[model samples]
Target: MSRILAIDYGTKRTGIAVTDELQIIASGLTTVNTKDLLQFLKDYIKNESVELFLVGEPKQMDNSASESEVHILPFITTLEKVFPKIPIQRVDERFTSKMAFQTMIDSGLKKNQRKNKALIDEISATLILQSYLYSK
Candidate 1:
């Protein structure tokens, strides 16, 4: 089976995660600058067989779209245009950041290490991918 890539899109940076070839065992791939996201995906896809794009959909507690949705929507449009064959799915990402932080603490990361925004983003992407896998 092809891999399912997960993206946690942020304004300044984007986090990426992917499942194994068997579509199991979600793992953090990397975090990239938002401006370089498409290029990163392009290069990654050249080396990997990706079947789907699982993007995080930020929403408020009341189920309304978050302010960041504006940014992600345009990116998604561009993504669709770039990779027409791959399907995209959005997973509700209400508290992934907080969960990532908790995971960092649980893992006993140092205070300085815990401040790594890129690491948090990567973890959040892994969580997003795992969420989709669990739902399936």
Candidate 2:
């Protein structure tokens, strides 16, 4: 079976996560520069069968689209043009960053390790993927 991929898109960096071929267990894949994300996905798809793309949809406390959506919407448009075969879905991403930080604290990561924005992004992506899996 093909795996599901999730993305936590940020202005400067993007977090990636994927489920196993059996569609069980979401795991952090990596953090990549936003500019390189398309190429990275192209390369990844060459090696893995991706069934769908789950993108984090940033929203404010009031459930309005967050400012980041301005950037994400364009990226989603391009992603559709590039990978028309794969379906894309949006998962609510409110408080993901804060949750990621708390997860790091619970994991007992040191202050320096917790300060790694890339790691937090990666974890956030994993959380998004896990949430999607649970929803299904």
Candidate 3:
């Protein structure tokens, strides 16, 4: 079966995650520059079969679109255009970053490692993927 991919998009960086072939577990894949995301996905899809793309949707406390949506919306459009064959979906990402930080702390990561924004992003992506899997 094709795996499901997840993305945690940020202004300068983007985090990626993917499910196992059996779609039972989600794991962090990598963090990439926002500018290089499209090319990165293109290269990834060439080697692996992805059945779906789950993008994190940042929403405000009132459930309205968050400020980050301005940037994410455009990226989503571009992603659709670039990979029309893969179905795309959004998962609420209200506190994935905070959760990622907490996860790092719980995992006993050193302060320096916890401070790595790329690692945080990757964890956030994994959280997003896990959320999607649970919803299904």
Candidate 4:
């Protein structure tokens, strides 16, 4: 099995996660600026055996698509254009950020560490990937 890449897409920053080749474990990769994401993915794909792309789908509490859907939909279109062979999937990311912060708190991270937005993003991506894996 090849690695599975998961993305927690945001307007400003996008968090990335990857599963092992066996697809048994999900781990945080890095957070990249939205402006640089396409080029970053291009570079990443050249070196990694990525089998799938999982994107976070923001949804409201009522199970409706969030306002960000307008932006995310276009991003997904671009992603498909760029990586046409790789399959893309969406997983609800209703409160991953909140869960990431709570995870940091539970993990005994210091306030300073908890305030690191990149760290939070990575954790959010990890949660997104885990959620996708669990759903499967």
- Please give each candidate's TM-score: 0.99, 0.99, 0.98, 0.96
> What are the candidates' C-alpha RMSDs?
0.4, 0.5, 0.6, 0.9
Clashing pairs in 1: none
Candidate 2 versus the native: TM-score? 0.99
Clashing pairs in 3: none
**Which tens-of-lDDT digit does each residue in 44-63 have in candidate 3?**
99999999999999999999
Q: Considering only N, C-alpha and C atoms within 3 Å, which residue pairs clash in candidate 2? A: none
Q: At residue 113, give the lDDT of candidate 2.
A: 95
Q: Write the per-residue lDDT of candidate 1 for residues 7-121, one digit (tens) a residue.
A: 9999999999999999879999999999999999999999999999999999999999999999999999999999999999999998999999999999999999999999999
Question: Using TM-score as the measure, what is the rank order of every candidate, best first?
Answer: 1, 2, 3, 4
Q: Report the lDDT tens digits of candidate 2 across residue range 1-136.
A: 9999999999999999999999999999999999999999999999999999999999988999999999999999999999999999999999899999999999999999999999999999999999999998
Instruction: List runs of model 4 lying over 4 Å from the truth.
Output: none
lDDT of 1: 0.97
What C-alpha lDDT do the candidate models reach, one value each? Answer: 0.97, 0.98, 0.96, 0.93
